[model samples]
Target: MENAYKEIEKGYLNMELLRFTTAGSVDDGKSTLIGRLLYDSKAIFEDQMEAIERASVGKGEEEVNLALLTDGLKAEREQGITIDVAYRYFATPKRKFIIADTPGHVQYTRNMVTGASTANAALILIDARNGVIEQTKRHSFIASLLQIPHLIICINKMDLVEFKQERYEEIKKEFSKFAPKLAIKDIRFLPISAKLGDNVVDKSKNTPWYEGPTLMYLLENLHIGGDNNFLDARFPVQYVVRPQSDKYHDFRGYAGRISSGVFKTGDEVKVYPSGFTSKVKGIHFGDKALKQAFPPQSVTITLEDDIDISRGDIIIKKNDTPKIEQDIDLMVCWFNERPLQIRGKYAVKHTTNDVRCMIKDIEYKIDVNSLEKDYDDKVVKMNDICRISIRTTKSLYFDPYTRNRETGSLVLIDESTNETVAAGMII
Candidate 1:
């Protein structure tokens, strides 16, 4: 039994994971969509189904309230609203998935940002009856800002709209009018009834006019292999491993996750800030030696020359390097309740490097609803998105968030309380 469990765990870890986030206005059936996905995929356990069934019965619901599968919080279940980011995991034969069901309330915009930060795709649901609204635009803008590769506009509650093709087109047209303003590379539309499980996991007969792939099909087959920046190599040093044993006394390895591009044995590399150049001696994954490594892969790298390297340093091709600067422009999303003060000092974290920084100036606040820049409003509050300037005490290595999401993003921690005050995308 222990061996069987270990085999199962190994198989799961080997499966490719697709991380996606769901965002929609209140009552747009975001929870129900996730519940349906888990249910139809047979990912739910018998005990969980029974618990949801019992909860439905206790609430005097005629049918099982599928939303209860994700609305796990007491207050959320009672209020029939999502208050925080609810994460769900499931797998089909094709691939494994991690779903972040973010709250639709405007006040929880920070939560939505957090959920979609690492997502490969953003599933934006819209009420078929209501067409496109301000919240829809806001979420779409956030997805664009975060540089999510795929944008899926699920027109939910199509059953309520009688599955009219014209209504679907109308909403599609409305969204298309606003989509060009975003940085979204790929956008697809689907008519789905999350409650009825139509066009979600299977094709809907009611919508014979639609010829697009179902939600599940698109998710499983979306080509996301080219999403990372493969041209610029970046490896941030996280730890230095030195096995001081007699058997292998000369093993010096720098352990870190490959941020972008590729690295191979015998490649010429340089350590950041120090400008120490060296040749790649070897790369290893635990006890196994590897010839090459790429983005998202965690490995230990060895250098030909023993240079002074430590945590917070970066390794890259000698000729290919990121910008090292003290002053940087950033598109920042304020997450704290207290407004961001100009010239306020805070701890800035970029990649593995942490240093002190001050808010140099506020350029303008973005109006998510109208997609306008309010140059007059410099006061950034909670959930406010704005472009600002920051000056750090020391130079840091970075790329534009548009160029590399892994290396371009950062967070500010308040010195007084150590709370994450804002999330920034290096401009």
Candidate 2:
């Protein structure tokens, strides 16, 4: 009992926030599953629960509609669906979490790609009756394309299917066959009823024949320790902090978030594009100096020499540097009203780096439903994922999105309208 309190207190006091995302076909109970997690884990306050209950009553639901807890926007409430990526925050005794409830519409594939890009794991829900549909493959393909390490295929609304073991196994067999073609490492399937609160937070008595940890158990115990690259140090300077007056005129610092690995004081690092060399003099998270900084943390770095570093420039270990290339191949999910031009220019934003790029060649288009490649349809339209070659004006220093998402991904913006046209994962 004391240990439980300690764990709860520690989580309430200081818990490391872990971010994850959920993607599935529309009305697959993604929001309900999340609501069940938060509600059953005791993450919701009384007032919040009251509000949810009140909203559910207003919506003419007999019981509190758990999906109402997440569908907070007016459009989503009216439509009874999620439109964009809705970010929800909650905490448990084990971890602090942020769940991005992404849309499943074909037109909203871009939103799923965006949400999955930074997620440690992708919780993919499958309706027991629907089995593996086209949207399921599309979501799974996106998770694989984004290189999400862990995948939880929650077979939801099992009660509707009579909680049949054969049906569950059949779905498992189907998904297993398709998973080998994906680039995922860990995969698990759970038969859950988000509506009845079975095997989501609590074990389901209806499925006494099945034996496995509840969905909550997996979420709490999943190993996310190696999610970030700890060996290759890369930091992109976002801002330069310069306090120029008679008081501290000599002060010059490079401010940015560490993309990967660990950077320590006095470490020898190279400034990109310029080939200039410098040693880290100090690390500042805020006002104080730290000995080192690590991934996903924002900080300011003061170097030993003022070597003409600017925003969008990367700092890395002198020996372990990423390749700088002008021509590259990337898997892109086209998301826009306008089609991609065969040979057109775009503003490519990758991490903190941005450059002008043009389509050099169309490699192939991937069929999400069938996993087939169509080479003849070179025309890129909305929600069609295709691999293509692009040539950037300046060399982009990066790696495969599979190696490092922060350095390996790029988003294309229309040059004329300044609208985000597509999201790409470098191959």
Q: How many backbone clashes does candidate 2 have?
A: 0
Residue 43 error for model 1, in Å? 1.5
The lDDT, on a scale of 0 to 1, for candidate 1 is: 0.91
Best by TM-score: 1
Give me the overall lDDT of model 2. Answer: 0.88
Question: lDDT of all predictions, in order shown?
Answer: 0.91, 0.88
Off by over 4 Å in 2: 1-9, 43-64, 245-247
Per-candidate total of colliding backbone pairs: 0, 0
Q: Model 2 RMSD to the real structure? A: 2.5
> Which tens-of-lDDT digit does each residue in 96-202 have in candidate 2?
88898887887788889889888888998999998988888888988999898889999999999999999999999999988889999899899999888889888
TM-score of each: 0.95, 0.93
lDDT of 1 by residue, 274-327 (tens): 899999999999899999999899999999998889899999998997999999
Model 1 TM-score on a 0 to 1 scale:
0.95
Candidate with the greatest lDDT versus the true structure = 1
